[model samples]
Target: MEDKNIFDMLENTDDELMEDFTGLCPEIDDEKFEKLFAKSEEDYKTRKAEIKRAEERYNTEGDNSVRGVERIRRPEWLRPVMMAASFVLIAGVVIGSTAMLRKDKWMTGAGTSVPEAETEDTTEEISETTEEPETAAATEEEKTVIDGSEVENITISTRWRDTVDEKIRAADDLVTMQQGFISMDYNDFIEFAADPSLDWNGPLPSDMRESEKDKIYYIRVKDEAAESIADLRTKMKDSYTDNYLDNLKDFYNNNRYYTDWAGSGFDDLNEGDMTDKTYIFLEYRGKLYVNSYVKSCAVSSGLGDSPLIIANETDTSFTAFLPHVTPNVFDYNDVSSDEPMVEIDDMYCEEVKFVLDPECNDWRIDSRIPHDSGVFGELYNRAAEE
Candidate 1:
């Protein structure tokens, strides 16, 4: 028989031969089998053509590697045998894929076959074993009883109340001091004609006339207030980090009309009520003018009862909530009036937070969440609008 007749012979196999092959394969309709066989034969032909080309090329350009060894060409029968094997493999794959697709079962590539029944049983067993313990543990935990000693371990210590009070006092003191500057005003245009320290040769502005040498008036911070300023320094050093202290110093030195106050000798500058000598005002062109110094008549606010509530706490750090209320402006110059100049109903109605972090030996105010500017902000804003 011709070499090309091999495929035809397989297709027209006798009833006995087909019966033997049928036992090993899944049953398929004749039409589907014929179509699959035709595709396999076409692929085999294309592969055979490629092999023939490669053999012809090898023959034309003899290989140098086989110089000493005998060159062995492929046998003629081997081609048909390989083609038949390829056809059988293709048909087997198609049949196997179809069967697997119909059943719709998963397979692993590792080639370790597990029985379907055994795999299902193992999966169910694993799920059951994992779920049962978790349910039992949850039920037992729900039934657990915590006694007094255990409760005490979880509760905040009573000593923390004192700490909270101390924090509130410190915060109150600092905020009050900051608001003290709101009522203070300094007139930069005031020319000190009487002062020997100022050597003035420049012409005065059209709107300003220099004060008579003897007509200068003095306005000063009170003695008690000066002592409080000294005390503020001590409190700040104790309650703030060096970085925060520097920031506070810079703010006071530049903005609060207290240029020399950042230095260690600030207490010496204000000793024995010397605030009068430091602050001098003059009537310039009929306008009341104060020199470099500021005169404070403050608008202040204080925290409510139970000022601080512990928001969160740990060994090294804690956060507290501050409720501010009853904001009022107190003008010392307004002695004729009994009541405050302005009593803001809800100046600091919003809650603010203060954080304490561990300093060298004690906890110090680290930072405030939204910097609480206090009653000064309200007064300043009102003054600006007016």
Candidate 2:
């Protein structure tokens, strides 16, 4: 039994791994397993291509740290193993990011104004302001952090694989859940976002995930009892994954954008939002819990979403101020992000929009509108007295 023989057996298109793997993974239906495998393989190939392109660009372009990690390409015999590894990674990203999320695309925007929530303690919020000293320079850092005492607990959901597997075993209960999400109003969507118990849908096809979130992803349709931006922010914090701040910082500082503010006005800049932003930030709150990972410097590009722009028709958009991230500041001479902390212009937070859809339909994002805008568009100077 040569090693290649085993690989060849695995690759025997018609009679190969499927029967054995399915025999092993009997939990999933053959159709579903095949679909998932095919989808995962496509994604794997795409990622591999992306990695290759990045490596090529790295060699051809200026050297940078963003391209530091390289996926070890195993011998062809290990293709199946490699595929499984990629699936696990992507699954983690999908499930862990969105508690009950639509897709991995997330947006955080902030500039000035926009704050309200029925759950919000306006009196308390106002009272909290007195503790801070306001300055002319403070105009850009307009966020107020919830005291640790005030925070209940960050709701991190169960692992994606287990949660998904459980859903599959539950006689496709997830499908019903998915259909029910479509009819949610802005407030309902917020509730869904804030809830840590829900997983967007089980064994959901990535295509379904992508299409559903955008199309059915409507928000702010009704003003009555609408969720305030403050309420949204507080709720969103419920399940933020580790290192979210760093991922956000990387997206803000490094994503390719027109940045009319910068002299680097979209010269060879990657267009779209989600890919440019390093962390798609599965909306556990906005939609799912938080999992933050460093973007591919966003220089190499993948996913992005600018929270600066808002949708008011089927949704509402708001800007965010990251008063807690850093002091409001910028260097006119160094708009180009040659260094991490150096290029950071302001203490920014993410902005979000709530989408409304028919509760009976499967949940979806509104793809017609921009899902990508160099991920998390800059808020400009938002810091100020709140």
TM-score for each model:
0.27, 0.16
Candidate 1 C-alpha lDDT tens digits along 171-227: 434433343422233222322224444322222211223442222222232223233
TM-score of 2: 0.16
Clashes of 1: 0
Question: Over the stretch 1-386, how does candidate 2's per-residue lDDT look in tens digits?
Answer: 69888777655353344667677654878999999999999999987786566445433332221223233455897888977976776565455434322221222123333356511544344334422223222432333223221111111112222322222222112112222212233232211111222223212222343433322221322222213333323322222212332243343343222111111112232222122211122222233311111111112111111112221223221112111111111211111222222112332332221222344232222211111222212322111101
Off by over 4 Å in 1: 1-161, 171-235, 249-307, 326-360, 369-386
Q: Once model 1 is optimally superposed onto the true structure by TM-score, how far is the C-alpha of residue 273 displaced, in angstroms? A: 21
Cα misplacement distance, residue 351 of candidate 2 (Å): 8.2
Which parts of model 2 have CA positions greater than 4 angstroms off? 2-19, 24-347, 350-386
Weakest lDDT window of 10 consecutive positions for candidate 1 = 147-156
Estimate the lDDT of model 2. 0.28
